[model samples]
Target: MKTTILPLAALGIALAVPGHAAAKSGDVQFKLLGTLVAPDGKITSVKKDLIGLPAGTQTKADDNVVPTVAIEYFLTDAISVETIAGVTQHDVDGRGALAGAGLVSNAKIVPATLTLKYHFGKDGGIQPYVGAGPSYYIFIDEKPGATAVALGATRQKMNDKVGAALQAGIDVPINDKGLALSVDVKRYFLRTTAHWYAGPTEVLTTRHKLDPWVISAGAAFRF
Candidate 1:
């Protein structure tokens, strides 16, 4: 009878294991995925006078669309860290109305960001998150036409920018492995000191303000 009772007790313990696992499913996990960032923002600039000409003018930096790839890691049930990188290309219209001379130029800016995020969800429902952080920008490949009266149009190299970021998003789960679809929006506030070398007799510098808003939709996986 003792031998019979031992086998029955073992079967009962085996059946209880699934219940224990279900209770512990709350353990932490990591997530990895590819995301796309579409940025929409306005550019404004401050100009200074040159050669006794009334310079010191501040104008819009130019408008453009930039694309990027993002990565994020979740540290706990409600916290995460993320990074995004991409390049931006835009055109300066030489203050069209200010310069009836018809001048236009192009500039390229690349932005990279790091953020801390907080997530919300209960019982595996839809999770929404928000993030705030800092961004670093690099300006390159600037070309301004000779007719550009804004000073150092072609001679300017606005290589660096520093700013802050604000973001919000939601994720919809698809399975137990933590596969989900995500949608997010972000805003970056930044500025740059634009400098140009115009021939041997001219060098110009200006301060620019750039604020870009980005919206992204993509798929994510958790491990």
Candidate 2:
């Protein structure tokens, strides 16, 4: 009886040791990813005083795919902090009454997000996570298109934005060396003001709500 108990106790410890040593504190992970930015929200004009425009004008942004990168530092086996950086360019066009008028404007958006993540499961398997935090958006290189130029608009601008972000992802281990494949999705709740100019005059100002959802898949290396 005593000999049988000793072997069973050793087997239990062996099974637990590998998982405990796999992911611990002070581990760093880096991921190189491809992200698809899809705009699932509407852009409504606060002021529609321009000619041939109706009240409550709205528009939609086009979808785009871009390269992204993320770095995560594990505080524990189950908790981590992650930072993500990416740049996406979007073409804004008229929806509803503004459809088929070509592009209204094009703008480049760079979002830097910091999140606190909670990871589930033990080692040697899939690690699923959920995260939430804040994001800072930098809007640059805005250009007015044919539709805006025809309306006597010379310049277009989008204000920089700061908003909340929510994220979820899963990581599948590829080997024992801490290399993994990651699939992630994140959403940004953002709103900003769009400024249209004719020479030195600010002709149109409207509130633009751009809640963009990002889906990403890539590889991660843990060290």
State which candidate has the highest lDDT: 2
Candidate 1 clashing pairs, residues 3+ apart or interchain: 43-61, 44-61, 47-56, 48-56, 49-55, 49-56, 155-196, 155-197, 156-196
Give candidate 1 misplaced runs (Cα > 4 Å): 1-47, 51-58, 99-104, 145-154, 201-203
Q: After TM-score superposition, what is the CA distance of residue 199 in candidate 2 from its true location, in Å?
A: 0.5
lDDT of 1 by residue, 176-210 (tens): 66666778788888767655555754455555556
Residue pairs with clashing backbones, model 2: none
Write candidate 2's Cα lDDT for 1-223 as tens digits: 9999999878655544243235678999999999999974366556645544664457778899999999999998789999988889987887777775544456898998999999986565567899999999898898877888887888888899899899999987776778788999999899888778889887777777788889999999889
Per-residue lDDT for 153 in model 2? Answer: 88
lDDT measured at residue 220 in model 1 versus the true structure, 0 to 100: 65
Question: Taking the candidates one at a time, how many backbone clashes does each contain?
Answer: 9, 0
Off by over 4 Å in 2: 1-21, 48-52
